[model samples]
Target: MDDRTAEYLVYLDATLTEIAGLARRGRDAYDRDIAVSRACQYNLIRLTADLERLGSDWLAHHPDIPWRLIKGMRNRIAHDYLTIDDDIIWAVVEHHATQLHHALENEIATAKTTLHTDEQTP
Candidate 1:
């Protein structure tokens, strides 16, 4: 991976970590607290936006990442906030975010290996 892609992956990993932390607060807090829900949404948006910055070529290499669905969610959150469903957000936080985080971790590890290999090659 190139430096820019590596940077974006790191950022996405961090944002997913933040979302995971918020998720640990549990469903009750998420349902009752606007702050918790909004924080999750905001972090998700940030995560998706950074995914966009990873560039098409990099995104293409990782076809399993659900690039379209991820970006669609970001658009829904950014452009249609009022109609956003709490249940969907909660589902994403509880399940999808965790899965995505794991995938991101793998990607980060691969990126590090790629960088190391590139360094050694020269």
Candidate 2:
């Protein structure tokens, strides 16, 4: 990964961490607290924007990540806020965010190792 891609991945990972913290607050609080929901949405938007910065080629290399769905969710959140469903956002936070965070962590570590190896190769 290039520096920009690596930077985006790091940012995404941190955003995921924020989402994970929000998720730890549990479902009832998420459902009752508008703040929590909005926070989750904001972080998700951040994730999508950063992911887009990674570029399509970088994204294509990781087919396992649901790039289209993620972008789609961002579009929905950005363009149609009223129609945004709490259940789906909650599901993403509770079920998917951690897994994605782990994936991003691994990717960031790999990128660092690759950069280190490249520096030593010359």
Candidate 3:
């Protein structure tokens, strides 16, 4: 991966951490009717943009991840925010988190290692 992809990968991983914390913020989101979940959902959308912006090289290697659904989710949030389903967000938080977490963490660490290698080479 190139430098920008590495930065985006770090962003993605940090966003996942934020999502995981937001998931645990449950009821708080429901009680005050907090927009935290919605905000976290937006972060997911942003992460997808980061993915898209990373371009073909990143996508080619991580083709197994849901790039399309992610983009769609972002569109839904941006254009159809009113009908946003809490359950779907919850499900993504519960199930998708682990899968995303693993991938993001690995990609970020690999990127960092490569960056370090490049620095040492010079």
Candidate 4:
């Protein structure tokens, strides 16, 4: 895989990890924690950029994942930042985190395979 692709996937992976880590803290008090909010925002931005920069084509081939909804989340974060609802973030952490993690793990494994093939070709 090219560096850009790998980097984006890493961004996606890291964001997923951040969300899961946040979920472990439990949700009731988590919504009020400043640190947790920052981590949530940070990953949202990272994943947003990854989707925006990579565009829909890459995601199309990877439709086994929720690429479209993920892109929509990024859109909400990027285009509607001022109206972001903390409750939505909380919901994502609680519900969507596991699915995204599994999807990204598969994507990353495929990228690694591509990287290995490219290395052998030269």
Best by TM-score: 2
* lDDT for model 2: 0.85
User: Considering every candidate listed, which one attains the maximal lDDT?
Assistant: 2
Off by over 4 Å in 3: 27-32, 116-122
User: Which should have the higher TM-score, number 3 or number 4?
Assistant: 3
Q: Each model's TM-score, in the order given?
A: 0.85, 0.86, 0.80, 0.69
User: In candidate 4, what are the lDDT values of residues 49-110, reduced to their tens digit?
Assistant: 66666667777766676656666777787788788788887777777776767867877777
Off by over 4 Å in 4: 1-3, 64-72, 75-82, 113-122
In order, the Cα lDDT scores of the candidates are: 0.84, 0.85, 0.75, 0.72
The sequence of per-residue lDDT tens digits that candidate 1 reaches over residues 66-89 is 878888888899999988888888
Candidate 2: segments with Cα more than 4 A from true spot:
111-122
lDDT of 2 by residue, 1-122 (tens): 67666667767777888999999999999889989989999988998987888889888888988988998899999999999998999888888888887776778787667666767985
Q: After superposition, how far is residue 32 of candidate 1 from its true place, in Å?
A: 1.2
Report the lDDT of model 2 for residue 92.
Answer: 88
Candidate 1 steric clashes: 0
Each model's backbone clash number: 0, 0, 0, 1
51 in model 1: Cα distance from truth in Å? Answer: 0.3
Candidate achieving higher lDDT, 1 or 4: 1
